[model samples]
Target: MTGHVRPYRSYVYAYPHKTAYRPLPEPGPALRDLWRDERKDALSLYLHIPFCEVRCGFCNLFTRIGAPDELTGRYLDALDRQATAVRDALGDTAPVRFANAAFGGGTPTFLEAAELERLCDIAEKRMGADLRAIPLSVEASPATATADRLAVLAERGTTRLSLGVQSFVDEEARAAVRPQRRADVDAALARIRDARIPVLNIDLIYGIDGQTPASWRTSLDAALAWQPEELYLYPLYVRPLTGLARRTAVTDRDWDEQRLSLYRQGRDHLLAHGYEQVSMRMFRRPGAPAQGPDDHACQTDGMIGLGCGARSYTSTLHYSFDYAVDMGHIRAIIDAYTGTEDFTRAVHGRYVDGDEARRRHLLQSLLQARGMPLADYRDRFGAEPYDDFPAELAAFAARGWLDDDAPDGLLRLSPEGLAHSDALGPELFSAEVRAAMAAYAVK
Candidate 1:
């Protein structure tokens, strides 16, 4: 509705580069040393619920369809064990005041009410912190949301709930295999509103197979009708192993033009409805109450991810377990808390050459629609961005990708740069940085 729709070829053959990511052995004293040196307090926790009642066509997240209820209960027990292990590892070094806690997965609401409460209790007891004060967010599918279920979540300190409403059109919804009906989404929103939860974020997707500009606009209009506190717009990404990727007819979709149009239209509609653009994909209404950070906290402030398929980060190392729900990875991570292992080696073993500190700072700044502060960089790394990335900045400025007149100590993206940000971002990095990132593929 607001931006141009340009037809471009979808890179069907584009393949992610292979990386040397190997699962680390169980935690030992070496891992413990890494945690102590980081001195992390005010942590964020992500609980991965890997069970879903139904699987969406486009999803590649670590989840299984039609998981038995008994299996869900077993996973909850494992989660409790993992949480305790993580808490013992931190041991009095930094008072663990949680900044944020999120329940993400196949569908957090899919868990039985008692199971959800037990998981929260385990996290609170093991972490030995006031969990109620921290912002607890969860992702829920509309079909799984009931008035009683939402009430349970709100009463248990869930301040925010993100509803996955990919599209409002029945045909498009069916094509994407989203489980809930449009009416179900409305009922879920009404229930959440009745509970008086402060923030509700609706997740909308564009550029899916069979999606059109008109259909996208319709979805936006329907979402606006609900007046959610925040809206997240994402282009559908085709993962190689997913059901959507296996659909041969997907090759005919106009993914490029559809994405551009969705972005433009969604932004315009949200702005008209009094939502301010907080980041590239997020929009919030003006004068909204202060809330916790988005998804980048783990990347910014070093977080200890304590479940299967979760990734952990420290100042120097970044490690992730394989996708399987293996208890061995959890035990290994616990072991690392006691001994002295080369954390840098542990992180690099997964994706070598990742400078967690630098990457964290840079990514945080980027997420804020700003650039890294020169002063902060100097204080932390004893080097200036210009000094470290002189050639890259110069080249970026020459191409009008960066503003030469930006504040002396700030590295902010220009309006033009923001408009075409995806293309412009890589220009800020040196060839070596790009190569390193390509080689790593942390996502």
Candidate 2:
């Protein structure tokens, strides 16, 4: 435990923070120019809902605990406005086609059944995205994943429903400050199964204070009972501004070793249960219904995001409304988002240069279990990944993390490397991006 290495840095999910984004001085025209020559064959649509029933202790996402009365309605109205503005900006030149759609955030299902219907309508009617033609995914929480709400989502062509169930043991959940009963979780699973959605993804967390290997196994078994289409095992990080941050420090190496061991245990358990390891944290049941559109992927395609916390991406810029973790800041951003009339230009984002784009391609590919196809990298960037990222690739190989000699010219992670994905992802961040992210004010 004393010498164990853990992932202590930032979670490198998306590149850059809203802090890196500056106001577009020209607004509408600037956005039009940015999207002028961008590829529009396969674009992803993301709609964010920033409200939650309760903020989990280990959570540090851009979402508020609860919305005041009428806030949800107003938020939808604002989303409609933004969608209209964005569509008009794309105009006739950008023949954008929706390849996939997802509703994410604190919890999209937190809205009432009727509101959820309206949410879908905005994406379909206002944004011109055919939700029924493409794969649609939505996130849900046990307390908010009501039957009526699930029905609304299912009716709107939701192919996959992901539910977050951190732990099956009530004590472990309480230790994580999640505050859920096993019975409620079980009931939620039952309801999700009854929803008859094409796919179900169950999310679990490891490394909670009181969670042991045995308890982790118990939760895994409980989740497996439903035979979910996908399972995402997340390692809990107590980040600043989160409820658990005040109670725990991020510099605990002993906890790192505990998490490493638990991760291995859980990974092995899921593998033995006939689940295929998709990455360090994701497992898919073979033959499960597909989750997203096959044509579009985050690695190359553009995305249009609506709602306060949602981040949209073009080839050059990734933009979003102001990002914040503290409740006060989140509420302020949401309020401002709901009040804004102009949505043509980016408000906050970091620019992606050629180098940054290369790095993004590598990070998006290398961190997965399927690994990066060397041929594909060369084809996209016109340069070999090893040549561009020589030092990083060599260091990873020396650390026994990457296998450079895989067949078909593929670069993939070893089993040990997969376990250290959290560390590897942050290590790939460029110095400039790292500095920008580090300088961001969490609140």
Question: How accurate locally, in lDDT, is each candidate?
Answer: 0.64, 0.83
Best by TM-score: 2
Tens digit of lDDT per residue, candidate 1, span 297-388?
54544566655545666555566544422223333432343232222223322432434345446545654555557788788878776776
> Which stretches of model 1 miss by more than 4 angstroms?
1-20, 25-30, 248-254, 324-356, 398-400, 403-406, 419-443
With candidate 1 superimposed using the best TM-score fit, by how many Å does residue 39's alpha carbon deviate from the native? 1.7
The residue ranges of model 2 lying beyond 4 angstroms of the native Cα positions read: 1-5, 17-29, 293-300
Instruction: Looking at model 1, report the run of 10 residues with the lowest lDDT sum.
Output: 9-18
